[model samples]
Target: MTVGASVKQTLANLKGAQGTLRTYSIKVQDESARSIYAEALMTTNKVIDDLNKRLKTIELEEPQYRAY
Candidate 1:
């Protein structure tokens, strides 16, 4: 679809990935593996936040993309 819809979908996918990483972090027994998952989860969270800000900017700059 449209750019807005595509970005929203990508955001959703990233959130899903974050959830999976969190679950893995909780379940894994190895200390190094847990640390790696935690780091990945943190990075994913940062990307999600940045993407959310970008989405807001996009909505503001392109009115047609708002609320979708």
Candidate 2:
């Protein structure tokens, strides 16, 4: 696929993951579940980092297609 499409998909995936993380955070907060919260936070952070790296690579390759 093209760089733009790839970047869009990656960003969508990252947003979905962020939503999931937020949900998990709320759940953990309400239930006072530290273990689950920590796990979710770690996973969320990793996904975010990967997404950022991929986005940077895409931007470097195609500087004209900026993501909002």
Compose the digit string of candidate 1's lDDT tens values, residues 1-68: 76777888899999998998999999999999999999999899899999999888877888886664
The alpha-carbon lDDT assigned to residue 11 of candidate 1 equals 99
Going through the candidates in order, what is the number of backbone clashes in each? 0, 0
Best by lDDT: 1
5-58 in candidate 2: lDDT tens per residue?
Answer: 776787688778777777777766555575677677788778778777887787
> TM-score, each model?
0.92, 0.54
Off by over 4 Å in 1: none
Model 1 Cα shift for residue 13 (angstroms): 0.2
Best by TM-score: 1
